[model samples]
Target: MKYLYYSLALFILSSFITPNDDADYEKEIKEWHKNRIESLKKENGWLNLAGLFWLEEGRNSFGADIENKIIFPTGKSGNFLGEFILSNGEVFIEAKKGAEIYHENEKVEKLKIFPSEKPILLKHHTLRWFVIKRGNKYAIRLRDLDSPFLKEFHGIETFQIDKKWKLKAKFEPTVGKKIAILDVTGQTSQQDSPGKLIFTVAGKEYALDALAEGDELFIIFGDITNKKETYGAGRFVYAAKPDADGFTSLDFNKAYNPPCAFTPYATCPLPPKQNLLPIAISAGEKNYGNH
Candidate 1:
């Protein structure tokens, strides 16, 4: 009897000492999330994104002119600072003599209005904007050099850290490129997709097809947690480029809400059909209150 009691005690002690992989993964995810929150709150982060103005075809005059030019916001001021000509996949903004352009909050005097390099900056007072190319379209992304949103910005909310949602997914390439249709606002467009991610949880297997966006594989997925614990429409997750063996980490703990969650001006992308999951993924960011 004495020997049996000692054996039982030893078994309990060993169980307590055993490493819990789930716990470790959750800790790592929490740290990554904390760092992300801090980065977004930094100067010049997405929290400062003020406006995304789409340029029309031909020359669109911008500045203080109400009739001829699109008027600048209150903090930004200038006269008929010339026009932003959008044509043939290129944008050229001709600035007047006294007009100043800024990157972030600092003046960029060396940046010419129509540089051969393209995507130059224009600034006045605490207002700064940059010309960028999205496919064949040209648009100006405006940011207030001293926007109040940045000044009063707070961190985003997240679900209680849980390790159960950190999943190891298997990548399965499609026979060829697949077409994915995206519905945003009232518009719908088709996008080319490489493949889908297959993973299992609670004895059930699931798959989510992803679209390429810049360097990351963008995935929009919905689950049972939607509208209750998660965002109603869906959420987004970006996986890094796969390794040589075509393997990548799909950590749902890093899932994040779209920009529309914070600001009404944002036109966010909705989740695709194949990406929706039937399981509850109880992890990642929660609903941001700003909306």
Candidate 2:
């Protein structure tokens, strides 16, 4: 009995000295999350996004005038003299005499300004906007539009900061390239995804196919936490490039809400059909405000 008790004590001592893998992983996840929140709150981050305007197919006049086809802010009063024509997937703005049009900090002649096949950069006060292409369509993205970082903007809320939600995911290649359809308010487009992320929990395995967004793999998932710990419809996650062994890190601590979570001006994409997870992901940002 004495020997058995000594062995039991030794086992407990060794367990404490070595520590548990889960505890170490949780620490890393928390640190990553802290860094991520700080980055998003930076001046140029997505939190600063404020508007999205869709251009009409033809000439659209913009000014402070209530009767103008497209209206500008009150600060831009009396500056608009002509209209911008959208024809053949291009925008042409004819500026009036003494009017200024700047692209990338340089003033250019505006008589027959054929701006890039992209959105023109415009600034008034601290606000900035640029034209962006979404599936052959053009729209303007505004930053610092009516920015009241304290009044209009509220910080992100999170779950109880549990570690079980931090998961290890595995990559599973598809037989061939899979095209995933994204349905959003302003755009519906198909994106090609290389494969799916498979992970196991509670003795069960689940998979979520990843869609490419610029250099990152974007994922939208719905879980039991929906409407309880996270947004009702779903939440988003961005994964970096896989490592040399085809392994990727999926830190749920970095999960965030779609742009729609903050404002009505955004047209965020919904999760594709196969990307939904069957388990509850009780990590990351929670629902914001009433919406």
Candidate 3:
């Protein structure tokens, strides 16, 4: 993994210093894009997301039938698979007599789905449903591995991968700072922000707040190309945590679309107001289709 990161770093550095052979540079980028597509096609990928049903404060009937409070994709599950009971912020699943649902790889007739340590994934055939908490609302995220979108997917269109867009940045720590993150659902939440990243492009300096995502720094940034060449909501980029010298890498060439770009079911975070840049970033993935 470190080798791959450094390889791309070298490829990106080539634009500034000595350039590598054209074939080797393109090979790394081609492999990177190939892995991106493979990830989107995986069982847990965004393409298989079929439904995202918000669980109300009551028994929410869910099945393949249209009348259920939560409906699975037509052929993914049985007509009357089960019902999710959400009471006082807790979620429990009660499957029908012969309906199949498994938690922790064991068949379950009735099981507590939420308020646990790890995420409990309930699987039935090629369908999988998991409980997720977003603010005060609880939702069941349903995925079908055999989704048509996964089968019909070709590849996302991208701009010519250029090395110049990969930039080295300086992380400036912010004391007692939090950022307001607004999701596509119009719900705003506050998250801890380490600081802003400052980088220079074409002798112009720009700063953007960096939100810690586990060990990575997640960035939701919008540029002038939005609504014309990229997803209207914006694109997402990630970087490794800062080193001892407060230095991190930002590769705009890897900035890609959010989950909402591919599916309406995703509650993706929109770029913050301050993160919108006036400049046009012509690297990375382009708008695929009107979503």
TM-score of each: 0.79, 0.79, 0.90
Local distance difference test values of all predictions, in order: 0.70, 0.68, 0.88
Sort by lDDT, best first: what order?
A: 3, 1, 2
Q: Which has the greatest lDDT?
A: 3
Query: Candidate 1's C-alpha lDDT?
Result: 0.70
Which lDDT value does model 2 have at 74? 59
TM-score of candidate 1 to 2 decimals: 0.79
Q: Candidate 2's residue-wise lDDT over 1-291, tens digit each?
A: 999999999999779864676577667766766776666566556666766667788977755576767665556344464566678777666545554545676654442333455446665455565666577776656666446542455567776566666667777766467665664664667667877887777889888888778877778887877777677768889887567777787768778887677656566777776666777777788888766
Which candidate, 1 or 2, would have the higher lDDT against the true structure? Answer: 1
Looking at model 3, report the run of 10 residues with the lowest lDDT sum: 16-25
The number of the candidate with the highest TM-score is 3
Per-residue CA lDDT of model 3 for 137-249, tens digit only, reads 99999888888878778899998988788789999998779999999888999998988989998999998898989999999999999999999989999988889999998
Better of 1 and 3 by lDDT: 3
Candidate 1 per-residue C-alpha lDDT over 122-213 given as tens digits, one digit per residue, 9 for 90 to 100: 66676667765444455567766566666775777787776666667777776567665554444556777877877788988888888888
